[model samples]
Target: MIRWALIFLVVALIAAVLGFGGIAGAAASIAKILFYIFVISLLISVVMILINKSKR
Candidate 1:
């Protein structure tokens, strides 16, 4: 997921450089959303790990 977000971020940068405003905007938004999701999932996984450790 983080890889995908980076890919989209690269695409957005390329598109912006080429003057593709709409494509750049869309790609950037997608990248932002994917990044947030990745962060949230990572946080959840960390919390789950901590909880499991505490249960031991």
Candidate 2:
């Protein structure tokens, strides 16, 4: 997921450099959404692991 976000970020940069305003904006927004989702899921996984360990 993080990898995908980075890929989209790179695409956005390239698009911006080429003056593709719409494409760059879209890619940047997608990258931002992906990054946030990845972070949230990671946090949830970590919390779950900690809770499970503590339960044992």
**lDDT of each residue in 1-56, candidate 1, tens digit only:** 99999999999999999999999999999999999999999999999999999999
Clashing pairs in 2: none
Model 1 residue 32 lDDT? 100
The numbered model that scores best in TM-score is: 1
Worst 10 residues of 1 by lDDT: 1-10
Off by over 4 Å in 1: none
TM-score of 1: 0.97
**Residue range with the least summed lDDT across 10 consecutive positions in model 2:** 1-10
lDDT of each: 0.99, 0.99
Instruction: Please give the distance, in angstroms, between residue 43's alpha carbon in candidate 2 and its true position after superposition.
Output: 0.5
Query: Model 1: C-alpha RMSD to truth?
Result: 0.4
Per-candidate alpha-carbon RMSD to the true structure: 0.4, 0.6
